[model samples]
Target: MATTTLGVKLDDPTRERLKAAAQSIDRTPHWLIKQAIFNYLEKLESGATLLELDGSAARDNEDRGELAEDAGLQCFLDFAESIQPQSVLRAAITSAYRRPEQEVVPMLLEQARLTAPVAEATNKMAAAIAEKLRNQKSAGGRAGIVQGLLQEFSLSSQEGVALMCLAEALLRIPDKGTRDALIRDKISNGNWQPHLGNSPSLFVNAATWGLLLTGKLVATHNEAGLTSSLSRIIGRSGEPMIRKGVDMAMRLMGEQFVTGETIGEALANASRFEAKGFRYSYDMLGEAALTEHDAQKYLASYEQAIHSIGKASHGRGIYEGPGISIKLSALHPRYSRAQYERVMEELYPRLLSLTLLAKQYDIGLNIDAEEADRLELSLDLLERLCFEPQLTGWNGIGFVIQAYQKRCPYVIDYVIDLARRSRHRLMIRLVKGAYWDSEIKRAQVEGLEGYPVYTRKVYTDVSYIACARKLLAAPEVIYPQFATHNAHTLAAIYQIAGQNYYPGQYEFQCLHGMGEPLYEQVVGKVADGKLNRPCRVYAPVGTHETLLAYLVRRLLENGANTSFVNRIADHSISIQELVADPVSQIERMATQEGGFGLPHPRIPLPRDLYGAERANSSGIDMANEHRLGSLSSALLATAHNDWKAAPMLGCPAGA
Candidate 1:
C-alpha cells in the first residue's frame, strides 16, 4: 500500500507521555500510533463499541491512551457512514429535480423557518445597517464604472441589451469585417439619443455621446445631400474607428470587472485592498475545456498561478491571505456525473495536484460552483479530496455553494457531514447564484418537470439566508464565506451570525470592483465606524480576450431590475423597500395573493410553453448518471437484434 507521513499536533504533556510509552514498549511512536489506529478501525468496522468490548481490553486501550478518543471518533464515523450522502443526497436531488415551485418553496420555507427563523429585532437591525450602506457613499474611493453604466442603461431597455451583446461578442470576433458589423448593429439598434446627458456618470454620458455619434453616422450612411456626403466620408473611415472604439470600451468594461490581465498583475493590484483588510480569491478567466489540449493549458495556468499566489501569500494562512478559485470543468474535459468513472480516474489527480500545491503554501483552494448538473459530481470530488491523507490537517480547502438551486440546503447537509467525517474544516462560500437564467432556460427546454432554480428572486434570497443560517451554526466544521453585494443580505448575515463579531467567525465577499464601496463600510475596526468584519474580493484575472462570459454574468446580475445593487444605485427606490425581509415578503404575498407560492406566471412549464398549441420537444438529461446508464443498457440490448422490415405500399389484409 502507498503510504505517506501524517503529522499530528500534540501538547507537551501528551508528547512526553507518548514518548515514554513508546520507550517502554521499545517501539517507535509512529508504529505504535499506526497499530492503535488499525485496531480501532477493525473494531469500528466490526460494529463493536467501546462499551461492548471486554473490560480488560478496554482497560488496556485506555492504558495505551486510545479508547476514549477512538471510541468517539468511531461512533461519529459510523453515524456519518450510516446516513451516507450517496443515498440521501441522491434521493434529495432526484426529488427536487423537476418539483413544482409551489411544492418546493413551502418545503424550503419550512427548512428556512427552522434554520434561519425570522426575528423582529434582527430584521430591524439589518434594516438599519442597510440604510447606512445606502446613505453612506464612499468619498473619492475607486468608482464602479460598470455599476454606473448599468444603472444608466438598465437591462430592461434596448440599450442595456445592446451593451451586453457588444461586450460579450465584440472583442472575440477576429475578422474586422464581422467585428465592424457587430459594432454597427449593436450601436445603431439602441436608442442612445435619449440618454445623451441623462446619466450623472461621466463614463455613461461619454459612452452615450460616442454611441449617438456612431448611430447617426451609420443611420445616415446613404442619405442624399451635403450631410449625406459628410456621413459617407465619415462612415467609410468610421467603421474601423468605430470597431476600435468598441474594442476599447469592452476592454474598459473588462478592467472594471477583471482585476488584471495576469496573475502577478492581479496580486499586485490586490495589495491596496489587502491593506484595507480586503482579501481576494483570484479566478483565472477561461471556460470549460472542450479538448485535452485546452485542459492541459488550463492546468498549466492554474499551476503557475498557484505558485505565484502561494509565494505572495507568504504563509499568511488561508483565512488571512489571498487564495485561488478553480473550476472543475477547466481541469477536465468531462466533469459530469455521466462520466463518473472517467472523471474519477482522469480528473481526480489534477484536482489533487492543485490542492496539494495550495496546501504547500497554506492558502485556500476553493472549488468554484458551476451548473446545477455538475453539483453532485463536484460533491463527489470534494468528498474524496477531503479524505485524502496527503491533504490531512489542511483547512484551506473550500467549496462554493449556490443558494439559488432547490437542492442547496440538502447539499449543505451532505458537505457538513463530509467535513466532520474527514476531520477537516471546510470553507463554504454561500452565494446567491449566478446561473439563474441559464438554469431556467435549460430546464424549460429539456421539458423537465420543474425548474432546478427558483423562478422568483425573493425565493432565492430566502434560500440564501436559510443556507447561511445552517452554515453559521456549524462553525466547528464550516467557515462561512458570505458573498453578496446586497446590503440587506450583508446585514441579515451579520445579525444572523450574532452581535459579537470576531475577525474570522465568518466573512463577507464581493466582486472586485462592484463590492468595494459597500464592503469598505463593513471591513475594519468597529471603533472606526465600520462593521469590523473581513470581506474578500472575488477578483477575476485575465485579459480582455477571456473576459466574455464572466463580464456578461456580472452585467446581467447587477443590471437586473430586481437586483438590490441596481435598486440601490437608483436613489428613487426607498430604503424600506430595498431592505424588506424576504421571508416576510413571501409570507405577505402568501396572505394576499391568489397564486401565492408559485413560480412566475410568465415563465410557463415546458409542456405549456406555447399555451396549448404545442409541447416542447423532450430531451434526456445527459448529465444524469442513472438515466445515462439505463439508456446505455437499452441501446446495448438492441444492438445485435436482427430486424426484417419493409414498407408496405398498400394496407395489410386485416386493415
Candidate 2:
C-alpha cells in the first residue's frame, strides 16, 4: 500500500520505549522505525490491529538506543512493537469462518421473509408501531391530541395539521410535570406564557405552550408541505371559526394581524373615542392580480373600505382616524402605464370620490408597496395622489417607504420635495420591506441590478436609523410613522428623538399584535411625558383567508431573522465554564432552540456563527419562518379586523 509520512510529537516515556525496541531489533533506530511504520500501515490496510501484526517481534531488538529523543522515530517504533501475529491470525480465521455462513445464508432468509405473507406481517408491525407512538405520551402523542382538537374545532385538514404542530412542540418538553402544568395552563387560561423562566424545563414547556396558544404549532407544521395553501384558503371557503382560531393563535404569537371586521371596529372605536393621539391607516388585502379586472375589483374594494371608514368616523365626529392603505398590485399586476392608468382611471374616480368624502369627514389615505416590479407603479400612483388638488392637505395623504430598498433614500427625498412643493405635511411610513426572500429570488432570476433586500442585518438597521434621522431632521416631513418592532431600532429612534426633543412630533407604529410589552412601555412613557411620543398600530383589516399571506410574512420576519435568545444564553454562560463543559453549551443551545426569541423548529443559531450553514445545521428553514409569520399575522390581523372601520367607505357587495 502507498503511504504518506505523518509528523509526530512524542513524550519522553514513549520515545524511550521506541529506542529500546529499535536496539533489540539490531537495526538503526531510523531503519527500524521505517519498517515499523510500514508494518503498521499494512495492518491498517488489512483491517488488523497494529498489536496483532507479526513483525512487532523485531521491534524489541532494534530500540535499545537513545533514538527516543527523535519523536517521529519513537512513534513508528512504538507502533511496530504493538503488532501480535497470533492474535491477527486468530481474528482472521474467526472472521472467515463466520462471514460466509451468516452473510450468505441471511440473504436467502431475508428474501424469503420479503414474500407476500412476510411483507404483510412487516407492514402490520410498522403500522402498529406508528399507531402506538401516535397515542403514546410523547411528542407524537401531543400531535394526536392536536389532531383531535382540530377535528373538534372543525378546522380544515390544513388548519388541523397546523394545530397539531403546536401539540408536537408541547411534547418536546423533558419534564412530565412541567408538560402537564403547561397543558393545564393552556386549558384554563386560554393563553400560554412560553418565556416564563430561563430554566431549560420551563423554557421547553413554555415554548410548547406558546405554540399551542398562538396557533403557531399548526402553522409551523404547515410550513413543510403547504406553502400556498393558507393563502389560497384565506378569503376563499374556510369556515369563520377556522379563521377565528387562526387569528387567535396568530395574535398570541406576536404578529401584526388584520381582518375585515376588526379593522372596521378599530376605526369605529377610534372615532368614538376621538383619539387625537394617533392616526389610523387601513389596509385592504389581496395581491398578484394578473388581470386589470381583478385589479379594478381590488381598487373598488379599497375605495369602499376608505369610504366606510370615513362615514363611520363622521357619525362619531372623529375626523382624524380615517386613513386607508392600499397595495397597487391589488389594483392590477404587470400593466403598462396607460393600461395601469385605465385601471387607475376606474380607480381614480372612486378614489377621488373617497377623497371628496374624506374632505368632508377629514380622513387621510396612504398607498402600500407591492412586489419590486410594481414598486415604481405604486410610487407613481402615490405621487399622483399626493399632487391631486382635492387631497393636497398634509394630513390627508401619505405613502409608505420600505427602508431596505436601495432607492428608498432617493424616494424619501422625492417625497420630502413633493411635500415641500405642495406645502403639505408628508406622512411617510418607514418599514423594513417585506418580500425580502422573494425579492432576492426574483432579482437573481431576472438578473436585476441590486438586491433591494439588505442581505446584511447591520445595513438594514443602519438604513432605518439613517432614514429616521433624515425624516426627524426635516420638521416639514411630519416625522412619518416609524413602523418597526425591532428593539434596537426603536431604542435608537427614541434616543434620536429625545436628543432632538421632538417626541410628540414623531409616531411609533407597531403591528397590532407584536411587541405588546414594548409598545405599552413606549406608549406608557409617552403618556407620562417621559418620552412624549404619539403611537399608532398599523391595524389591518381583511378576511382571515385573505390575511394568511400577511400573517405568514410576519412570522418569517421575526422567527427566521433574529437570534437574540441564543446570544443571550451564550453571554450568560461563562467562556471558561463553557470550554470545560462543552456538552453543557451544546445542551443549552439545543434547549434555547425553542425558547422565546428562538421559536421552535426555526430556532436561531448560537451567536458565534453566521448564514445558512449554521441555520441548516440547526434544522431551521424558510418554511418554519413562513409558518411563524403566518400564525402571528393571522391573529393580529383579526384584532384589527374586529375594530370598527371609520365610516368613510361602504362595505363591499357582500360584507
Top TM-score: which candidate number? 1
Cα lDDT of model 1 by residue, 1-655, tens digit: 2323333435699988887998798776656778888998999999897655568887676556754444434433332222212355566665565567787677667656523443655556566766776677432322555566778888999998988888888867889989878877888778898888887667779878989988877766766744765876776788888888878777776788889899999998888999988999999999899999999999999999999999998879999999999999998887876566678889999999999999999889999999999987888899899999998888999999998888888888888888998999999999999998899888877886567788899999888988898999899999999999887678778767778876568889999878887888888888998878999999999987788899889889878999887887677888778887777788888887765567787998877777878888777776554555456556544644666675666868544
lDDT of each: 0.81, 0.49
Best by lDDT: 1
Number of backbone collisions per candidate, in order? 1, 82
Q: What range of 10 consecutive residues in model 2 has the weakest lDDT sum?
A: 97-106
Ten residues in sequence with the least summed lDDT for candidate 1: 77-86
Stretches > 4 Å off in candidate 1: 1-85, 113-120, 136-144, 224-228, 625-645, 648-655
Error of 2 at 627 (Å): 37
lDDT of 1 at 100: 74
Q: What lDDT does candidate 1 reach at residue 633?
A: 54
| Per-residue lDDT of candidate 2, residues 1-655 (tens digit) | 2333443445789888877887786554556667888888888999885444466557444443324444434434433332222223223322221121112222222212233543344344333322332234422333223222222222222332344333333424556445434433343333334333433343344444544444443333235565676645632433233334433444433223442345566566444213445545677666656777786777677767767777765543322354677665565555433245354565455555655665666666666765544554455565567678766653666578887665555566667776776677767789888777687555444433334445533344455666776787777655478987654456556555554554337777766544332454455444463344556666667654455567556544433313221111223433233212112232364366532111122212222133455422222111122322344445433532335555566857444
